[model samples]
Target: MDGQRDEGYVVVVNSEEQYSVWPQGRELPAGWRETGERGSRESCLAHIDEVWTDMRPLTLRREMADGTGR
Candidate 1:
């Protein structure tokens, strides 16, 4: 794989509030949208790490909160 430092990336989030880094200037995958934060892959990952403190998906979190999840 190419060095991530050479490529640009953007922070993206889905309905589940999960965050990820997508290639800058590339079309985002279905159900994911850019968070308007763009930079080196490391920066994007840092952004996700800072914001995505909870690893669980939105639905699972909700279920847990409602006492429905395992």
Candidate 2:
């Protein structure tokens, strides 16, 4: 991210259900897309904290369920 305040921020999510904060209006990284969420980094982080209680990615969850997780 540019780290400049003018960039603002947005929340992003990937197929694995991971949540992250990214620079607003910036190009998104692979496998992650915008969630239509825009705000300060702190607010976005707080949203992630609240909604992303299960930090494990979807693959990990499937692995654990299949008894193949470490």
Candidate 3:
């Protein structure tokens, strides 16, 4: 946990035209519906705000080896 932590974001879109934004490397919870136009854009934005507000920060090790090294 002492190493520098990197942050990233991703937006997932499903066949139904619905989507959810999540911290890039993590999996969305089971049964969490990620897509649909059921809610307005404002609602979706608000939901994202609410969910990310409480998410714990993630720490990751850097992958420094390049193509030559691998």
Q: Tell me how far candidate 2 lies from the true structure as C-alpha RMSD in angstroms.
A: 2.3
lDDT (tens digit, per residue) of candidate 2 on 1-70: 4555843999999999999999887799889999887888888898898899898999999999999999
Clashes of 3: 3
Q: Compared with the true structure, what per-residue lDDT tens digits does model 3 show for residues 1-70?
A: 3231333444454433344755444576664444432344445566666555433222111122333322
* Stretches of candidate 2 exceeding 4 Å from the true structure: 1-3, 66-70
- Where is model 1 poorest over a 10-residue stretch in terms of lDDT? 1-10
lDDT of each: 0.88, 0.88, 0.43
lDDT of 1 by residue, 1-70 (tens): 5644545788999999999998877788899999999888887888888999999999999999999998
Candidate 3 similarity to native, TM-score: 0.29
Could you estimate the TM-score for every candidate? 0.87, 0.81, 0.29
Those runs of model 3 whose alpha carbons end farther than 4 Å from true positions after fitting are 1-7, 28-70
Off by over 4 Å in 1: 1-7
What C-alpha lDDT, on a 0 to 100 scale, does residue 51 get in candidate 3?
50
